[model samples]
Each structure stands twice: as structure tokens, then as C-alpha cells.
Target: MYDVVIIGGGPAGQSAALFTSKGQLKTLLLDNEKGLTQRALIRNHYGADDVPGGELVAVGRKQAEKFGTEFNKANVTNVIKKDEGFTIETEEGDTYEGKQIILATGANSKLAETIGLNTKPSSEPYVKHVVDVDAAGRTNIEGIWAAGTAAGVSVHTIITSGDGAKVAVNLLSDLKGERYVDHDAL
Candidate 1:
């Protein structure tokens, strides 16, 4: 089974995969390549002064792939909990097993409902039907997490990216059976 299966390709999912894969966890990121980030065109997204959203996605995915994170461009149709972990089924009729799942499907997406997680409407202005998550981006189900806009955070790429990193770190800590501090060098 893979260490983590991230269910989104947006900023949140990509950022999470970057961290998880860098942490040496076998990671798989599934996405159909159509998130709110596709429309992003700005200079306020941290490092870069100006860049298209698609460019960011491409660079982030490339970086994660360089770190050994697998990418699947398919629509995830269903997720089922198993004795070992979880099974993610895609519209392409493929299944992947993972020790953990992270939902980064963006705001108002109800992918969690298919997995029996209790989701609620977002209280944010004009935001609706966001997945319910705890402080650590945890869903009602164990081994499953919701991050970025999927967790009811703002739709901004910067905030969602940070949220994704935060959720990834928390999930990594849980998987290691102790607190995991990400250290780049010896």
C-alpha cells in the first residue's frame, strides 16, 4: 500500500505531495487537472511575482515527481476503507491502496461524502458544502484528512498551500507513531 493518497491536484494537493514525498513516504496524487487554481493569475502567490496558475501546477507536480511521488490524471470515483488502509477507485477502473488519504478537492466538493465522512456547509461568505475537518485537517474518519479549501480555508493559493503543508506534516507525524519534524539536512 502507498503511504499516502492525495485526492486533488490543486495547490493544496500538490503542496502536500511535495512534503510527503520529500519525507520519504510513498505518495500518490490523483487529479483530473481542473481545480479552482486553473483560473489563478496573480503576483501575490509568494515567490513568483507573476505566473499563470497552470505553470505553478506543472512546476509543483514536477517537483513532487522528482521526489518520487506518483501522479495519476484520473477522476477518483470512490474510496473504501479496508483492513490495512483505504482503497481509492478511479473512473479509469483502477484501484490504489494507501495508508492515508488527504482530501484537497477544493471548496464545495463533496468527495468525502462518498467515503462516509460527515461534511457540512461552509460558513464563509458565498462558500458552500465544505468538508468538515478538525484543527489538524482531520475528517470524521480516521486516516483521512481534508486540507486547503476542502477544509474550509480561503480559496487563495498561498493560504491553501500553507494549509496543505500543515496537514501533510500532521499526517506524517501520525504515520510515524510520533512527532515528525521535517529536517532537510544533517
Candidate 2:
């Protein structure tokens, strides 16, 4: 079983994997190529003068991979709550289990509802629906989280990426049984 299973492969999901795997948590990142990252042409993200959204996601995935996050190409069909944590089912009939799960499934994504997350009509004009999350991306169900636009944040690349990092840190801290500070020091 992995420490965390992250759904989605956009900025948010990649950012979560970067921190969780670096924090000593075994991570599995699953992607189905549905995210809008590939189509984004970004420039407003801090420190990123100009970059393609897909390139940013690629770099983040590589960075996470360097820290030992497992990457998989699969279409996830369901997240089932189990005693050992959660069982992730893929369209290919493969299943994985993890101690925790992060749903970074992006905006207008409906995967959260399958796992019984509390969802509401999205207040954002462009978003049709969003999972309800606390400040740290916790959904109504324990051991499950939703981040990025999937958790009802602005779909801007920067916001979604930062939200991913924030949610990752929180989940890592919970797993560590203490607060985890992934601080950069000179």
C-alpha cells in the first residue's frame, strides 16, 4: 500500500506528489490526460516568466519522480473506502490501495462524488460543480482530500498549483503525526 494515492496529473496533483514523496511518503500519481494543463499557455505564475502549462506539469512530475513518486497512466473509475485505507480502481481493472487519498481531479471533475464527498453547485461561473473542502482540502470523509479547482479554487495555474502544495503538506503532517515543515533554507 502506498502512503498516498493522488488522482489527476495537473499542477495540483504533481505538486502534491512532490511534497508527499519528498516527505517520506510513498506516493502514486495516476493520470488520465483529461486535465487542461496541456492547453494552457501561462505567464502569470510567480518565478515562471513564461511557460506552457504542460511543461510545468512535466517538470513537476519529473521532480516528484526524483523523490520516488510512482507515475501511472490509467483512467481511474472509483475510489472505494476500505479498512486498510482506500481502494483505487482503474478502468484497466487494476486496483491499488493507499493509506490516504488525494483527489486533484481538476475542475468540473465528478470523481469525488463517487467516493461520497460533500459537493455543491460551484459558485464560480465557469465551474459546474466542486467538492466541498476545508482550508486544508479535507473533504467530508476522513482520509480523503480534494485540492485544486476540484476543491473549489480558482482554475488559474498558480492557484491550483499552490493549493496542491498546501494540501500535500497537510496530508503529510497528518501522516507524520506531527506538523511537517518542508521549508527551504539557504
Candidate 3:
């Protein structure tokens, strides 16, 4: 059981994993390597200007790995809040339990489920873009935080990456028994 199970491997997930691991929290990053930001043609992503979106993903994943963050290439299909923590279900019928669950699943494209016309296992949903978090990156869920596009961040690759870093720091503070505060400097 990890201290925190981040359910996405995007910028937000990676950021959270990096910080939590550095704080010595057992962290796991579950993603399928198709985060929305990975499809961007980034040009103004903070220190990385005019770089491909893939490169940014590579660098971020590598950094997180270096920090001892465990990466699992899996898709979390369902989550259940439990007495001690939470349980996550994967596409392969595997279950993972954690003390804390972060829903960094990212924005899934909205597809109106109508009279069944073959919407199952064919269309990959698009992310809605995370941008609802406050300056400190707290989400609407209690004890549940968010960052990056999962919290409704902008499409600017660099901007979202910065947003990830911002939320990451805030989460770190939260782990350290500090009052939940948003550190925008991330």
C-alpha cells in the first residue's frame, strides 16, 4: 500500500510523484502514456521553449523515476473509497489499494452516452483540460487535490507544466502536516 497513489502519469501526476517520493512517501504513478499534454506542440513551456511535447513527457518521467517514483502503465477504470483509504480497479481486472488516492486521471473527453450506438471500447475520450484549482491548486474534492490539466489547466504546454509544479509544492506542504496552502512559485 503506497502512501499516495497518483492515478495519472501526466504533468500533475509526475509532479506529485516527484514531490511525494522526495518527501519519502511511497508513491505510485498509474498512467497509459497518453496524457493530453503529450500531444502538444509546445513552445512556451517555462524553461523548455520550442520543444516537442514528447520530449517534455520524457524528461518529466525520467526526473520522477530518478526521484524514486514508481510508474505503472495501467489504466484506472474505477475507484472506491474505503475505510482505511481507497481501492482502484484497472482494465486488466487488477486492484490496487492505497492510503490516499489522487485523481489525476486528467480531463476525459465528454461523450454523451446516448442510446448505445457503439461507444464502447472504440473511442478514446479527450481530456477536458484542468483549470478549476485555485492559485494553490486545490480541487473541489475534500482531501483530494489536483494539478496540471486534470484541474482544468490551459492548453499551453509550458503553462500546464508550470501549473503541475505549483500543485506539486502545495501537495508536498500538505504532506508535511502544514496547513493546505497553494505555493504559486511552483
Candidate 4:
């Protein structure tokens, strides 16, 4: 079983994976390749003046991969809660087991709803729904968390990315039984 399974390959999911894997957790990122970021032509994100959304996402994926996060291109169909962890089913006939789950599926809440996660109307413009989460990204269901647009954050790439990182830190702290921080100094 993976230490963490992230559903979504957008900024939030990728950011979370980068942290989890770098933190030494076995991580898996499952993406369906259909995020709004893929079509964005981002210019407002911090540190970059102009960049294609797809390109940004591609780079993020590479960054996470560098930390040993496994990436799978598949549409997740179901997330079944198990006694120890979760069983993720995909449309491509693949199943992944993980001790924790992070929902970063952008504005799409279909999977969240199907899995019985509590949701509320989204505050972000154009997003109708989002998974209900605590300040630390914990869902009503234990072992399940959410970040980015799916967690009712702004659709902006920078904000979602930060939210993803925040959730990752919280999850890592839970796993480590103490506060977790990651820093690389030159």
C-alpha cells in the first residue's frame, strides 16, 4: 500500500505529491489528464511571468517524480474505504491501495460525492461544489483529505499549490507523530 494516494494531477495534487514523496512517504498520483490547469495560459502565478497551464503541470509532475512519486494516467472511478486504508478503482482496470487519500480533483466533485464525502457549495467563482474539509484539509472521513479547488480554495494556481503543500505538511505530521517540515538549503 502506498503511504499516500493523491487523486488529481493538477497543481494541488502535484504539489502534495512533491512533499509526501520528498518526506519519504510512498506516494502515488493518479490523474485523468482533464484539469482546468491543462488549458490555462498562466501569467499571474508567482515567480513566472508567462507559462502555459499544461507546461506548468508537466513541470510539476516531473518535480514530484524526482522525489519518487509514482504517476498513473487513469480515471479513478471509486474510492472504497478499507479497514487499514483505501482501495482506489480506476476506469482502466487498475487498483491502488493507500494508507491515506488526498482529493485534488480540481472543481470536479463527482468522485467525492460518489464516495460519500461531505460537501458544501463552493465559494470560488464558477465552482459549484467542493469537499468539506477542516482548516488542515481533513475530510469528515478519517484518512481522507482534500486540497485545491476541490477543497473550496481559489482556482488560482498559486493558491491551490500552497493549499496542497499545507495539506501535505498536516498529513505528514500526522504520520510522523510530530510536526513535519521540509527545507533544502543551498
Candidate 5:
């Protein structure tokens, strides 16, 4: 069992992994290389200057690894709340448990093409994923929170990363029973 498990490996997921692991929480990051940032050309992000999204993700992953974040190259099939924590099920039948789960799967890109229009379900099955968290990136599940695209904010890489940092601080505070750190502190 880990202290926390983050789903996805995009900017939000990476940011969460960094903070949690740095705070000494056993952390794991799961992604299947199909996150939203995978296709981003990303030339306008701050600190990135002109780097591509894929490169940024690579660097972030390396940094997280250096910080002791565990990486699981698997696709999560389902997440269920267990008695003590949460259980994550992967397509390969592997299971992981964590005291807290951050749903950072990022926004489902397929919805963009369907928005502002009405259509029937496709003859072929389609998956529609939504991140409906609020401004502060609070998830629908208790003891679980989210940020970045996973929280449904329209954000570039810079903004999303910032949100992830904020969520981490808040999460830490919740665990420590201390004052929540303001986003500016991050």
C-alpha cells in the first residue's frame, strides 16, 4: 500500500507525484502514454519557452523519478473505494491500494469534438470521461482531490501545473492538520 496513488502522467499527475513523494509519502504514478499532453505542440507554456509537450513530460517524469516517485506503466481499468483506502484495478489484474487517490487522468479529449452539439451515442462504443472538480480541484470522492485538467479547468500546461501544485499543498495540509498553504507559496 502507498500513501497516495496518482492516475495519469500528464503535467497534473507529474506535479502531484513530485510533491507527494517529496513529502515522503510512498507514491505511484500510472499512465498509458495517451494523456492529453501527448499531442500538444506546446510552444507558449511558461518556463518551457519553445519545448514540446512530450519533452516536458519526459523531463517531469525524470524529475519525479529522482524525487522517488514510482512509475507504473499500466492502464487503470477501474477504481473502487475499499474499507481502509482505495483499490486500483489494472487491465492486467494487478491491484494497488493507497490511503488517498488522486484522479488525474486528465480530460478526455474526445469530448471536445462533441461539445456544443447534440448527437446520439456512436454505433461503436465510446468512452466519455469528465473532470468536474471545482476551482480548487476538489473531486467528487471524499479523501480524493484533483487538479489541472483532471479538475476541468481550461488551462495550458503552465496553469495546469500550477493548479497541481496547489492541490498538493492543500492535500498535505489536510493530512498535517495545519493551515493550508496558499497557491502563491508554491
Candidate 6:
């Protein structure tokens, strides 16, 4: 079973994978290739200006892969909670087990709804609904989390990315039984 299974491949999902994998978690990121980020032309993201949304996603996936996050192109169909974790089924007829789940499917809560996660009307413009999550990104169900626009954060690439990282840190801390921090020094 993977330590964490992240759904979606947008900035939020990629950012979470970067941290979780780097922290030594067996991370798996599944993308359906249907996020809004793929079609964006971002110019306000910090540190990267005038970057195509697709390029940003590509680079982020590469970064997460560098840290050992497994990447899969699959459309998740269902998530069944098991005794210890969850069983994820893909539309391609594949299955994966993960001890924890992070839903980063931007602006789409259909999967979350199928899993019986609580949701509320989204505050973000243009978003109809979002998974209900606490400050730490935990959903009503334990071991399940949400981040990015799906978690009611702004759709801006920068904000969603940071929210993803924050959720990762929280998950790491919960697993480690202590505060988890990652800092690189030159």
C-alpha cells in the first residue's frame, strides 16, 4: 500500500507529491489530465512569470518524480475505504491501495461525493461545489484529505500550490507523531 495516494495532477497535487515523496512517503499521484491548470496561461505565479500552465505542470511532475513519487495517468472511478486504508479503482480496471488519500481534483467533487465526503457550496468564483475540509485539509472521513480548489481554496496557481504543501506537511506530521519540516540548505 502506498503511504499516500494523491488524486489530480494540477499544481496542488504536484506540490503535495513533491513534499510527501521527499519526506520518504511512498507517494502515488494519479492524474486524469483534465484539470483547468493544463489549459491556463499563468503570468502571476510567483518565481515563474509568463509560464504556460501545461509547462508548469510538466515541470512540477518532473520534480515530484525526482523525489520518487510515482506518476500514473488514470481516471479514478471509485475509492472504497478498507479496514486499514483505501482501495482505489481506476477506469482502466487497475487498483491501488493507499493508507491515506488527498483529493486535489480541481473544481470537481464528483469523486469525493461518491466516496461520501462532506461538501459545501464553493466560495471561489466559477466553482459550484467543493469538498468540505478543515484548516488542516482533513475531510469528514479520517485518513482522507482535500486540497487546492477542490478544498475551497482560490484557483490561483500559487495559492493552490501552497495549500497543497500545507496539507502535505500536516499529513506528514500526523504520520510521524510530531511536527514535520523539510528545509534544504546549501
lDDT of each: 0.89, 0.89, 0.64, 0.96, 0.72, 0.96
Better of 2 and 4 by TM-score: 4
Better of 3 and 6 by lDDT: 6
Inter-residue clash pairs, candidate 5: none
**Which stretch of 10 consecutive residues in model 4 shows the poorest summed lDDT?**
120-129
Instruction: Output the worst ten-in-a-row residue range by lDDT, candidate 5.
Output: 115-124
lDDT of each residue in 30-92, candidate 3, tens digit only: 887877767877766667768777777788889888878888888677666677776778888
Candidate 4 stretches greater than 4 Å from native: none
Colliding pairs, model 4: none
TM-score of 6: 0.99
| True lDDT of residue 108, candidate 3 | 52
**Over 4 Å off in model 6, which ranges?**
none
Task: Report the C-alpha lDDT of model 5 over 1-186, residue by residue, as the tens digit.
Answer: 998888788998898888888777899988888876877889877776777789999999998899799998987777777788888788878999989877676665332222211222322223244555555556656666776765655457887777777787678778888965433253
lDDT for model 4: 0.96
TM values, all candidates: 0.94, 0.96, 0.76, 0.98, 0.82, 0.99
Q: Given candidate 6, what's the lDDT at residue 91?
A: 93
- Candidate 1: stretches off by over 4 Å: none
After the best TM-score superposition of candidate 4, give how far the Cα of residue 117 lies from its true spot, in angstroms: 0.3
lDDT score at residue 84, model 5, on the 0-100 scale:
88
Give Cα distance to truth, residue 3, candidate 1, Å: 0.8
Model 2 has how many clashing residue pairs? Answer: 0
- Residue-pair clashes per prediction, in order, are 0, 0, 12, 0, 0, 0
> Cα lDDT for residue 184, model 2?
72
